[model samples]
Each structure stands twice: as structure tokens, then as C-alpha cells.
Target: MDAKVMNQILEIAFEKRVSDVHFEVDNPPFFRGRGQLIRSKLPKLKPEDTEFIAKTILEANKRQLDPSLREQDASYSLPNGGRFRVSIFRQKGVIGIVMRVIPPHIGSFEELNLPVVLSEIVKAPNGLILVTGPTGNGKSTTLASMLRYLNENYSYNIITIEDPIEFLFTSSKSCIIQREVGIDTEGFGAALKAALRMDPDVIMVGEMRDPETIDACIKAAETGHLVFSTLHTQSASSTINRLIGNFPPEVQEVMRQRLADMLVAIVSLRLVKDKSGENIIPVVEVMRSTTTIQACIRDGRLDEIEKHIENGVAQYGMQTLDQHLIQLCQQKIIAVDEAKRITRSMDLERKLMFTS
Candidate 1:
């Protein structure tokens, strides 16, 4: 409960320009800087000290960090305007905490260097839009930017279900309602089930972690709510397959139908090292659900969906990861070798590198 300790942690997070801060017993705290991670020079924390810090995070948020206290998590803001989604848990019987720094204000598409399609995604009237990527790939940031765009441009009520709410939104052109997983509702599934009853025009789910959550999200979309969520997948097709695969075999057919009906677009993305080596830029593969894509999902020809993504241009706003990477390379936003290193298509990467 020491203000000085909390201030020091915030200072450390800001000084490193880190998106996250990690603290674990017996190990010195470390922060994830721009593109790399570095250990904090502060002395290693004791168990009691770690607990105190984690508890402080909980107290600051005024949310039950965790029900059982075996592991704890909370979202809180520093006095200086930075926010954090902090997770505290026991690993190897020692307390460990990770504080993901949330910027004071949301970054615009231009500032984040995201694609123009993102602006279009925010303006969608109905259906679901998914942002797909790995951890630390700025998926949350991308989602937040879209939500902020909607806020600034439209008058819609937005409800969010997040485990530890990341970016904070103040009403712009819309009224926003954010619900934390444990604090606001029992869980994502329960919160999503309740969200529909609230009559929201837009629903933002933090992550689709389970079938129940996905089911509720789909239902929300079906009933005409614009749904936005994230998934940990490598490609737009993978994101679709993962969604259908989340359901049981017996019900997958039904779920696929529901998904096809409500699906709008999937933006599978990753952060590749920039040419300047000072930052990372986002590369995305977009898949807009068309009639053929829907038929592919229904007929179990998910593989063919990739070809549609590779070729579809005027029909829908879509592109393949390899192509997106190539554009980034041509634009001098990212290096060819770096794109090749992170690219999933080895053959395509080779061709890209040679041509460029």
C-alpha cells in the first residue's frame, strides 16, 4: 500500500516505454521495452513484497483481484494517466505479476500505421470483425483503435467484456460500457449472455476463449449487433477454422452456419520489425466473408478459402499474409529479411526476398 512503491513501478514502466512489466519472486522485475525485454535494476522482490505490490494493484482497481486469491489480476491506472492490465499469479509456488501498460490515449490508424481497412471495419453496420494475432502483437491496440474510431464518428452504445479491461474509453460520439470479467460478471460467457439483454449497438469481446463465449458472440451478431473480438491465430482462414473448430463435432455444422451468416471480416496480423529497427509495424491478412467463402466453410473446403483470400481484390477487401508482407517490404516499412523470418509461407518468402 506504499504510494512510493506503486509510483516506482509506474516510473519503471514508463521509463522503458514498455508495454508490460513483469515481477516475480526471487527474480528481478523486468519490463518489455519497444521491441525487446530488459530486467529492472531494482533488487529482486521477496514474496511478501510481491504480494504487497499485487495487492496494491487490486486495491487500486477496487476489484477483487481474483476470487480464490491463488492467482490475482486487476486493471488500474497510474496517477500519471497510464493504464495497466495487471495479472498476478503463482508460478512454481512463487508470486509472479505482469502489468501490461495501456497508453493514456488511443492511437489513431495513422499513428499506429495500421491499414485503412481498419477505419472501414469500425464503420461496419453489422456482422463480426475479428482481429487475429499472437500475444504481444498489438491485437488489443488494434481493437481499441477501431472502437475509438466508432466512438468518435457514431452515436452507438458499445459494451465490452474483458478479463482485465485494457484501454479505457471515454465517450466520444457513442456511449461506452466496459465490463471486467470477474468484477463485472462471472466470466466472458456470462457477461456476453447478459450483454445482449443490454441492447448495445456494438459489442467488443476481449477474446473468444471458449465455445460458450463464441456462441454468445455469434448470437449477438445474428441479432444485429456489431461484434468485434480477437483470436490467437496466424491467418484469416485459420481464424475462421479455429472458430468453427471450437465447437464440438456434433454441433460444428450448426456453429459454422451461424458463423457464416454473421461473419464479416477477419484481420489476421503480426508485428514485423521495421526497416529503421526502432519499432515494429503491423502486417495483416484480411478475409472478407463472401458467398464462396461461406460455401467453403459449409462444405469443409476451408483450405480453398486461402486461395480466395490470395486472389480476392475487388470483390471484397481481403489479402493474404504473404502479399501484405510483400507490400510492407515494397513500401520500405519493414525489411524483407525480417518479413521472411516471421512469415508462415516459406516458399512465398523466398520469392519475395529474391524479387525485392
Candidate 2:
């Protein structure tokens, strides 16, 4: 397959710092930058153009475009060190593609404007740590930052099982091994299970997508390996509930008990525009496994988790999303209107403004 046209499109995306590039039949190419989609001035793509792009991308990655399958996900790296997570699918019986840019360098926690508490989360010796958020919300980037921290500071065998392996980590003080899901191993669950035998001191699972993967991650943590993973939940409480809810009703109680014992912390992130509206900043909700938090999880008092996070900000280094938003607003890192849109709690906003 000829990839010249696709390469040109990707090079443009790289230069513009575009977060995503979209190609669809009958629609002009578009770039999603700073949370907005901007259409290219170029004319709409023809069906053949999209088909050629799709085939070229798949061929470049040594993947096949199976018409029988409605969708496919892959990742490709450019010769100039740019990488993208590509999703190609059939829409209206025509090919369409979405490519997300992955930065070549992994930013530090401070560089990413992540909370300082994240440093503590990455330093833990062993337990399950989760970064939870919806897709395109910087969840993978946050986890990558943590792994990079460990790589730079400690000497351990770190194994990461990713679908397409987003960040490429160079060995600093650690022996880092990255395995792609379909390339290096069979899948997340199988790779995780094999990682246990690989003598990994730290393990990063790209995502906990199913019960088997979740159970394997918990077991790996229980067996004295520091495990980090991501989930598609909006809040700390929701992340916990989602994990336990993945199991059958009969096994949920058991899972909860295990989670209470083996869980370390949960960090939920949302990226909103900074004060200039030109960049995104993360508003985070952190929940550490204190004695009280452990009890709440074991006893199924999930509703109280948020309150604990609110009250424990000063003592436990836990912060609710509202608390973080308030801090950002007070520091002029984000405008009040933007903060209000994110928090979506006028009463809480008033309390934050009036308190102190």
C-alpha cells in the first residue's frame, strides 16, 4: 500500500500539535486541537482516498484491513519519532480513520502539571494503583509519567503490557520491558499472568478491560508487585465500584475484601482548559487507602469515599475534584467560570468561595 498521502497528513498533524486527525469519506479532513475540531481547508475526501489511507496505515503496521470486522485498532510510529494510536473502521460502508498523537517524550508529573501527591503514589513499594478517567482524558499519560518516575529513581524490573505501547521508556535505573498486546504477547490477561513469572518488581497494565484482567492485576499486587493500571470511570468511588461490580454478585464481596487489602490509591483525572484556554490542566481526585478508606471499601460504604477525600486533603494528601478545582481557581490557574463548568456544583463552589 502507498503511504505517501497518509505520511503527509501525519506530518501536518505533528507540526500543528494536533491531538487527533480524522479521515472520513465525504468529509474534509479535520484536526482536534485543544478540545475543538477544526476542518481542513482541503476538499472532502473521496471514498477511494479514505480506503487508500486505511490500507496504507494497516499495511504500515503489518495489520490487515478485514472487511468482515467493522473496526480495528493499531498504533504506528513515524520515521521522525512521532507515534500515533490509530483506529480504522467502516462507517456507512466506507473507511474512516482516527489517529491520536502520542508525544515522543514522557513528561514528568510536575511538567504535566499533575498534583504533587502523585509522587507519593508512584513511590509505593507494592499495591494496586489506578488512574481512572474517560478516553482522551490523559489517563495513559499520567500512568506513563508514574512509570517514568520509577524508571529514573529505582532499580527494578518493570514490565508494561500495553495494547500498542504508548510511551517508549529507556532504561535509566530500572530494567524496563514493554510488551505490546498483539505483538509481544497474546493479550493483557495472558501477558499479566506471565509477568508474574518474569520477576517484575513493578507492572503496568495498559488497561483493566475485563474481569480476568482485573483479577490478574489484583493478584499480581497481592503477590508483592507494584501494579499500575487505568480505568474508564469518572471518580474515585466510581472506580472502586466499577472494579468490584465487574465480578458476579456472589464474588463481589470477595473481590471487595481483596481490594480493601491490596489496593493502594485511586487517582481520577479530568483535563480542562487552562486560564489561557490554549492548554489543558488536570483536575484530580485522589483517594489513598487509609484505615478509614479501607473500612469504607470493605463495608461497601462507597458514597462516603468522596467525603473522606474532601476532609483528608490536608492530612492524607487526598483531594476531591472540587478541592483541586477550587485551588486552581484561587491560584488563577483556571478561571472561575471554567472551574464551575468542571465541578458542576454551584453549592460546592459557593462553599469553596465563602469558606475561609
Candidate closest to the true structure, highest lDDT: 2
Lowest lDDT sum, 10 consecutive residues, model 1, at 63-72
Off by over 4 Å in 2: 344-346
Error of 2 at 150 (Å): 0.3
- lDDT, candidate 2, 1-356, per-residue tens: 24766787788898889899999988888999999999998788998898888777778767777778588787877888899998888988888999999987799999999988888888888999999988999998999999888989999999999988788889999999999877788899899989999999999999999999999999999999999999999998999999999999999989999999999999999999988989988999899999999999999999999898889988889998888888888888898788878674667668666863
Q: lDDT tens digits, residues 260-324, model 1?
A: 88888888878877888888778888888889998887787888988998778655667888888
| Model 2 local distance difference test score | 0.89
Shift in Å, residue 41, candidate 1: 1.8
My TM-score estimates for the predictions, one after another, are 0.94, 0.97
